[model samples]
Target: MTKSTIKVAALSAAIVTALAGCNSDSGSNNVTERPTIAECKTYEPTQPVIVKGDNQDLNFQTITIGATGDMHGRIFAYDYALDDVDVNAGFTKISTLLHEERAQNDNFLMIDLGDTFQGNSAELFNPLPIHPVVETMNHMEYDVWVPGNHEFDFDRDFLFRNLEGFNGAVISSNIIWHENAVDCKNTGQETPFLRGYQIFDYNGAKVAVIGLTPSHVSSWNASNPDNFRNLDFKEEFESLENTVDEVIAQYQPDVVIGALHHGRSETHGVVGVNEIASKMADKFDVIFMGHEHARFIEQIDLGAAFENGMDDITVSGDKANQVEDKAKSGTYNWRNRDSKVKVIEPGNWGWALAKAEIDLFKDQDGNWKIYDTTLSNRTVADVEEDAALQSEMQHVHDKSVEVANEVIGKIVGNFTNTSNGGADEAVLEEQVLNSEGQRLYTTIHSAKVSDMPLTDLINQIQIMYVEEKGSEAIKEQIKVDVSAAALFSDASNLFNGDTYRRKDSANLYMYDNQLVAVNITGENLKAYMEWSYRYFNTYQYGDITVSFDPEVASFNYDIFDGDIEYVVDLSQEAGNRIEITSISGSDFDKTATYVLAINDYRFGSTMLVEGWVTEEDKIWDSSNETIYAIRDMLTEYVGLNDLYRTEFENVNWYIKQYGPSDAKGNVADEDKGEILQLREDGGEGQDLWERLQNKEICVMRSGPGARDSINVSVNVDNNNTWFVNPNASNPYEGCTYSNQPK
Candidate 1:
């Protein structure tokens, strides 16, 4: 039999053995599981009802809002191995926590902020009809949920299909869909599709929950905008303000809640937590924010209820601050307004729970008003896995393992891609030891250089895939000018001689970034390189150490491959790092247009590749109509090549030259001033090139670090992580680089 057939037979046999370990007694016989594909297909949409037992009572004074977001397919809890942090992230543990909270509090409501679907490497590649993750949510019993930007990671229909399996109230004020929202609005009945908002009767409290999705969902899947072009992510802040006013005038609820799939930030307005928080505090009593999977806890006091030139009467509450200590006592008639609210944003995954509890009292007039409140947004870590929940998910987990291990191809040899923050200990000890025999990583006086095969491999994969998407004439007209990728991990080492499994290919490339090819001019390409190299710090005349800004996310440290060679003069400022010397060993013409292959995320994400791409110039998008995820493409490439080998990689195209050489390496006095002048000018002359080639001034390579580049920072914590263009209003800053008509 051929290799592909033989491999499938082996995988099938292995799946039987792996699946045998699952809890057959529980998984196979659970009548409570969701319906079959046929039943789901023919089913009509219905609102998920609140399940009540004989002991369950609807009357309660305290109302708790349970929140979750960015589940990202983490159905089971696993060890994360962070040193200072405990990780208990998954739906199983979250299920137990949610269950316990319901019994303790009389009124408990749960909500999932967008990103409810997608993610989880195992089941994602070939998902079952009824997603097991959503089925698990059905068991946990959620009250409401809205789609996140990633919800569109698959086809638009796929999201609607998954929503079918979910047993929760669907509420999102900003998601404007073409098919479902109009019917739901006209009928005014609770349906499974879409709605502007939903009102809940929490005992005697009439609480309105407003759902909002990320506004940038449009650019998020730019490569595959065809699937979601019919829908639009409305301008949220203003839309939310209008919705709150309308909900008050119509429903006249005692309490209003803002639950969204948006992240919290220190900055105000647009993409800021404090900015949106100020607007929310005007009408909503409680808010749950998500998107960025980080820990946060804050009690934003937007002055007093009507203290900041506002009226409580707009929200059906008494106006003006009429009590001492409005925050603590809650005695003002405006207390019932959106004043003195609490916001929680439990971290992503099943890692933790975002929780809020509000105490509402019926005044002498019998109108519900807030008495007191408490809020907490943190992770629930180091907890025991819920055994029953674990059993329910056991079969799916086993199947994931079977699928993850399916061999796709074989590798020629083992390769190195150690992500030791570019500081190789062995390289340090042998090559970068101090004059006193100390490892340079710990010393401020050493420098090191490491090969970046991981980044190289990713670039190669993207380029190969981008080339295949078009014909020879099209490619010849717009050659892959350059391809971009990053060494996202420090320890992605691939084994040689072993068969490459589907999971191994995933490890080689994590994240579901699809391929995008766009046309960029030579001038814009230089600017793009300058933007990428901003992660590296400038060099000075000291006991130099090669260190990176931890604030700069590792994903931003992208390397490029093409028919060009450029030098990164680290001594320059953030916007002036690259010195493009040649295009195919000749002067680069500023007007030459070339095709640039990049992952869809970078091209569309606010934090990375947003500044350069022109929307109209998009040539070929791998996800235009279908999600040809880069990882899946890589797997295909490996299988087609028969042997996944890197020996064929040219390992050329670009180089990193330190700025010290431009200053004074082994240069004579006559050329010292000239070298410095050309370095600052970024000239393309041959004499300047000869001076840059010498390693005595600065190390140059297509790798991580070469000697000890200076003493680098070893302390990298999660809090220090930062993104590019975080403060821009339009993630792309309206900077569309190309112009191609639809």
Candidate 2:
């Protein structure tokens, strides 16, 4: 082919490529071939994007995106010791880095993905005044912000109030406020309270940033019925696709990016960064994801992503096989490279900043086209703290510490997250044991009775509250058992001291799990314990540790109390692994039915394993929607007793099978085995996961006066409204609202 002939063929291919990318279509192979309109114009491009570039032209412009999310109100620096070297992070450090980045690049956009206005001791109060985090972001001049899942952790009214308080534009494409939802100052209508997307005309590029919140919002906010009841969240993938198609037709942006509060993984039907890249990555240029509180820069190839069921493939032929871009780094597509979807997530708590650098050039037709890119995160520890920012936020910090220190109660002993002294660290160190044997001796499973403090305190408060608040008949006839998720279950602890402050309360509970009571047969109770124990991988002999499945959050694993003693047989499969050793200090009774005190989460949560609490099992409900209702109740209980020392109690229940057993199902290990009574095995845990893991824990009940002092709502959310079939292993119910009065 002559140079002139080759130029013509190349020009034709470039025009088709630019047009295909802008309109989100698969371009044709042969320049002479006239592809069907359906193939190239199913969704009209923003139009006017120049399609005249040859294969060797320089990009028109370069744009840099500096984004952060999951701030969690860390307006001030937090302390930690690294190799005995103290390090800290706060908005002050973030501001310094951000300023430096913006100064270096003129074409820059600053964004916050979400999870602000909550996380600190102050957020638990929902101050009548504005939060410092919002003000600091405003001062920093953020260009855009997307509300994350934690933003809904506040009261029903605080949801939009905080979002509106942001200094920059806020958008969410999938959230539609319910008609009777709590009234906030909502004037926007396309998707009530949330604008879909914003288009920026910058440096000759029409870049569009569309916002998206996770689709499982309802699941996470179920405990806060007042807030969740009025919000309609559509599936992420569908909502994102429709929004992208609409934005393309309306704005014809040179590049499109997604600002989503979702994360990298494919969580059910939610369309997160991974989902977008695999199915719609070629459609949108870049995505900033939040929610998992992790940090990483990765790419997704649509053609390759489809192998994992990420269907739609728009980029085709040679373009699909193009070499991976410089800006796109890491192997996250389960280690495949077949398409182009770039995603960024900065760590939470102002720990790092994700800077995504990309270059773009318009085709001869004047449309912007992104060609290459690179990304990296700057840790706050590496950057100098901004003095001015620190000074500005100092007052906020002082005020929080003041409010947190207000004494609320007294404690006798420190509640720590450490496991039972791990086989005497000194003794274990003297002997070089095998890895498996070390695990067997040091690891303390959640089932051990000694590991029961955190759960015991919360459950005690729950049972006591139900006793005092239930109807006189209920108080007289019903014996209550408490089910707590162990607030400080992992490595968190509540310090023991002469006096406890509000900060202790804040530390004690991290979720808005309201108090709830329900009825369960002793048989289902066994099933519940079985389900809880299923989380732990079977204890292996000669192992230093027992690990649980992370996919199944520890928060979902409830620790039951109130005179019931059960032995967990991890060797058995789920649904039948619980062995009821004793009940109320007597032989286990399969026929006994008991009134159970629980958080609204576990009572109505869809994350409950196999066959547990059916919607019909829920009976009593709390009027107040306090996130830390258990803590508040505990404070009241302590006040009633007028304690001056620690009030947390040791649970009476004991685990029968703690370590590995023999070939006959009996615990044979010389270590803490079956009946590894308290003090022998690791004592009660220091903490739980701190907050609800399964956003699906949103199953909530009666609002305000829906019930009186009895804590039982004759008129309430139906207890029988879960799982359409109620018998299915994995439940999927769309309509969760059940307002019919009992």
Candidate no. 1 TM-score = 0.71
Q: Write the per-residue lDDT of candidate 2 for residues 619-713, one digit (tens) a residue.
A: 55554422236655655555445332234445444333444332212334474552232223343210111111111211222211111011111
C-alpha root-mean-square deviation, each candidate: 12.3, 19.7
Cα-based TM-score, every candidate: 0.71, 0.69
User: Which lDDT tens digits does candidate 1 get at residues 1-742?
Assistant: 1444323324445555554443222222123444322211222233222332233233337788788888877777641111111144678878778878888985788888878656655334223445666667767777777778887777655666677556666677766543343333444432322565777776556778888887777776766776564566777777677777888898788777888787654211354455566656667777777776644444455543321222221111211111113343343234445454556666667656777677777766766777666665434554556788888877766566556776777777434432232223222211232221112222221111222344556777777767766433255544586787766534344555777777766665667778888888887888877777776665543212245553355566678866666666565778887777777557888788777888887777632234565788778777542326776776776776754435434444322332222211223335343223344444433332232222111221111112212223211121121112222343222111110011
- Candidate 2's error at 305, in angstroms? 4.9
Candidate 1, position 518, lDDT: 86
Best by TM-score: 1
Model 2 CA lDDT for position 389: 70
| Model 1, runs deviating above 4 Å | 1-60, 78-87, 122-127, 178-193, 265-269, 303-341, 410-414, 417-451, 472-478, 495-499, 536-553, 606-611, 624-627, 640-742
